[model samples]
Target: MNDITISNNPDRERFEVSVAGKVIGKAWYKAYDGDGQAERIFYHTVVNEEYAGQGLAGRLAKAALDETVAAGLGIVPVCPFIKSYITGHPEYEASTVAITPAHLQFLDKALAARA
Candidate 1:
């Protein structure tokens, strides 16, 4: 198995994993600024079909969450995988913020604006 590399593409609002420069997985997120604070809401995470079962998703999750915490931003785990991942990882629990109606509204508007 080839070693995978993870990187954050802030413009795309995702943390991606690649094998020899070809992207194989991504964890998508959106940044919301409100209530005088900033948050990164992780909404989806995926790995290429052929890349499944290689632990790439977990890798992406770890890297993405780590970076979010390092950047001093709260994490709103809207994606089930991210929410579950945080559940088993106690270290990241401190930075997590539960999803609320305001977050949902913000996400709806942000996604709608893109469409």
Candidate 2:
């Protein structure tokens, strides 16, 4: 097994998974500032095709969630991968928040701004 590592890239707003110093997967998130708290909305997760079935995605998700919880932020799992991952991991329930319509609206604006 290669030395798999994961780190949060705040500038990209994603958690990156790397192997042997090469990034091969990422879990993208957006932040929604509300009520003096930051909610991290995980909207997309992707692992390189060559790295599929290696559990890197799960590792990446865990790292991202860990960092968010550690930072005292909420986790809004808008991505199916993240939502399902949290469902199977009850430990994250405390930090997880269900996605709302407002979240979708916010994402639309964020993505559009980037485009």
Clashing pairs in 2: none
Models, CA RMSD each: 1.0, 0.9
Worst 10 residues of 1 by lDDT: 31-40
Q: State model 2's lDDT.
A: 0.92
Worst 10 residues of 2 by lDDT: 30-39
- Per-residue accuracy of model 1 over 6-39 as CA lDDT, tens digit each: 9999899899999989998999999988587899
Clashes of 1: 0
- TM-scores, each model vs. reference: 0.95, 0.95
lDDT of 2 by residue, 1-115 (tens): 6688899999999999999999999999998885677899999999999999989899999999999999999999989999999999999999988778889999999999999
**How many clashes (backbone atoms < 3 Å, residues ≥3 apart in a chain or on different chains) does model 2 have?**
0
| Candidate 1: RMSD to truth | 1.0
